[model samples]
Target: MSHLLIPALFFLVILVGAFIQPAAARKPYASIPVKNLFSYIEILPPGSRVLLAWDYDPATQGEMQLLAQPILRHLQRKRVQIVNVSLRPFGPNVAADAQTMKQWPMSAQAAAPTEFGFIPGESAALRALTHSPVIASNQPRTSARTSGLRPTDTLAAFDLVIEFSASFANSQEWVEQVASRTQKPFIVAASGAVAPLLRPYQQTHQIRVLLSGYPDALAYESLLQHNGPAHRQRTAQTLALGLLLILVLIAATRSLLRR
Candidate 1:
């Protein structure tokens, strides 16, 4: 019973922390990459065109969506012309769901993104986009038509390119095919599992901003001055980790005293 006390207490603490509200006044530590991402979006003109690539599927949607929501909100606030595209088949549906959940007001709905839906060729499609932005006529459209994406428009036409990627290969393809060719300001919000592999691109300056994992998401939300889901999740995570550390220290002390 004595040996089980620490584990039981730690579990109870985590359970309670999940139900508690995060302290609104607590400031999140924003990293340099997160700050750079915020600056890149902040300077965009109201009508600037942005290419938003949703490259993740439902398997990684849980993390990808949390990272995407705040960034989407920031883009909407900037009032940029967003052109949505995807390399993954399930990506278009996921992007559509995110847009629906974060729908703009009736007045601003006219300015919502133009969905190009899923582009099937992956790396080959990205290479094509460098010269032309048009998707195949057979591809399904998910949203209302917008004006900027024309048959003649190329990848360079967009002011910025942002990709929320789950796969290292897909993100790498974008870096190699589109971003390197167009020389556009490329931003990638990748999953924690894939982010370390992408660091080389960021180091090469091919990716202007790279945001990954819950810490960066929480930091980005802090920079936006919005307490969203990341904040609540981070609070719970911190509580659980801190409690575990304390329990470990207590157990070590007890063992030392017995010795």
Candidate 2:
């Protein structure tokens, strides 16, 4: 009964909280990382080319999607030409969905970001991007031609590399094979559990920005002053956690009185 009651109450609170839209101002520590991410995107001039790697699959999409959406929206607002690629098979599809789900005017939509589909060879594929960008894409010849991306071009052509991943291997591969070699600034948006493992790289100055989980998401939303999916997720998380903690305390008090 306690188990059922606690979870039922939790879901009830979360369901109610998810509807509220306002995201409170975040603490200084939480705001710092989000501000750094925004600053990187803000520095690029309009129409600068950016390579965005969508590295997570559907199993982790709920969290990753929420994290990626605001950044994509921010990039679109800046009028950058985005070339998106993926290592995982379903990654292109996930990236497509995140773009489609964003609230942008059909007319104001920046040129639809180019999708390079999926690259099969992991570290080898990433290395190829630095040397032979077009062939590494595996994109149809005509599509590459239309985008004006020559086979001679390399990853160095892009102004920046931003990766959203749930996999540590994907993140590590990017750092060791791509960013470290190309010497281009890189950013990562990772699931909270995986963020700690990747933090050491940031400390060593291998990457620029790292955003992890709901707290960071809320901070980003506050920075943007635009509430979206992350706000909903944060509300749900906070309400559920707060309710569960209260329930535990009540149960302890009741047991003490009975004793």
Candidate 1 local Cα displacement, residue 62, angstroms:
0.8
Clashing pairs in 2: none
**Total clashes, candidate 2?**
0
Give me the displacement of residue 23 in model 2, in angstroms.
4.0
Tens digit per residue, CA lDDT, model 2, 18-103: 53323363332456778888888889887788899999989999989878988887888788888889989998999988987887
Candidate 1 lDDT, 21-134, residue by residue in tens = 355656778899989889999999888888899999989988998899889888888888888888889988889878876654532733767877788887788878787777
Instruction: Please list the C-alpha lDDT of all candidates, in the order they appear.
Output: 0.81, 0.80
Candidate 1 ranges with C-alpha deviation above 4 Å = 1-22, 103-110, 135-145, 235-259
